[model samples]
Target: MSEPTPTTCMRCAVGCGHLQSGREDGHGVAEAKGNPEHPTNEGADCQRGIEETVDPGGDRLTQPLVRRGGELQPTNWDTAVGVVANRFIEALSNGGGDIAVLGSGQQTTEAVYALGKLARGGFGTRYYDANTRLCMASAVKAYDSAFGSDAPPPTYDDIPKADTHLVWGANPKTAHPVLYRWIAESAAAKDSQLVVVDPVETQTAADADIHIQPAPGTDLA
Candidate 1:
């Protein structure tokens, strides 16, 4: 193994520090371990991180492909980029009103910032949005209506101080294992009441003191 390099895992919004060791030839990652000094996870890593390092599945696309005559063919980087650029130019020349850019929440902050700059400054279009908007738009609207601002008041550190915790429409056990572990530990230590509101009985709901399964669309009601 090569020398371990400290880096941050980008699988989710919650950044976790890790040490990645590459192969001796430095081609790919060989092993990964959580950084003990990191406040977020403190030497605890989820299955996602381990899978990313050791068991990267074989279904990845290494090169760009373009469709020609109803058949996809491998193409070089320049050709692929030219195709995308031409399409963007054509779309902008026709009309910028209907053209919109959608970004993923899983992307790095730098990637998202660059995309925003490209959409707003380069293309001069206000039709750009991220996947986060799909999930948080309702909550943000409610917060804005109630408090005149969209900023949330609570942080992850506030979880331990609460006497009761309620989770809704999220399965943190699979989505955020490290955070779920922390919540479980806190609940066990404090004997706090845990309530889960979900349409289905998830692993998190199984651990909760009370699981309320309301109708799917009636959550807001």
Candidate 2:
């Protein structure tokens, strides 16, 4: 196996950190090990998350392609960017309201922030949305109910220091193995309470100090 090279996993929007290297047995395989020091995951590795890191990026585009002569052709970055800008300028000239952005869920926090800025600040468009609005609706609602804002105040660093960890409607054990590891380790070290509230008893509920399973669609309805 080649020496493990530290790399960031872009499998999901979480952007977990991991060490990737070649297979030791010369089997042409790759193994990914989560980095314990990463603030995001804290050394958690879900089976699916690790599996994505091993993919060779099949059919993924490496460069910009522009349609030319009735076919898409690889072009330089500057040319490709200019083409897009010109199209956007043309659209804006007609009406900025015509432009809209529906951001993907497979984006980092920084990417989403930038997209928001471009959509609102740059384009001055009100027609903007993100997949997070659909996928993270529960988290958003919880945050709003708790803090009157759709953003969490506590960082991951607060996990280890807290006397109690309450995971609501989240199954970190399967969905976020690294975060589950962090909570489990912290609770074990400090004898802290680990409460999990979900509609179903999941792997996370199995690990929690307390599991509260409300009827499906009945929590805070």
Candidate 1 has an lDDT of: 0.83
The window of 10 residues in a row where model 2 has the poorest summed lDDT is: 22-31
- Give Cα-based local distance difference scores for all models: 0.83, 0.81
Clashes found in each candidate (C-alpha, N, C closer than 3 A): 0, 2
Worst 10 residues of 1 by lDDT: 90-99
Over the stretch 51-136, how does candidate 2's per-residue lDDT look in tens digits?
Answer: 76676556878689999999999999999999999988987886678898999887777899999999988988888899777678
Assess the local accuracy of residue 143 in candidate 1 as a C-alpha lDDT between 0 and 100.
85
User: What's the TM-score of every candidate structure?
Assistant: 0.74, 0.63
Q: Which stretches of candidate 1 lie over 4 Å from their true place?
A: 22-28, 52-58, 85-100, 142-152, 197-202, 209-220
lDDT of 1 by residue, 1-221 (tens): 98878888866666788888898865678898898888888989988977776667778776899999999899999999999898889878966655689998777778989998988877777899986587679979888887788967666788788778888889998899988877887776656988899988899999998999998888876
Instruction: Give the C-alpha miss distance for residue 138 in model 1, angstroms.
Output: 3.1
Provide the lDDT at 116 for model 2. 93
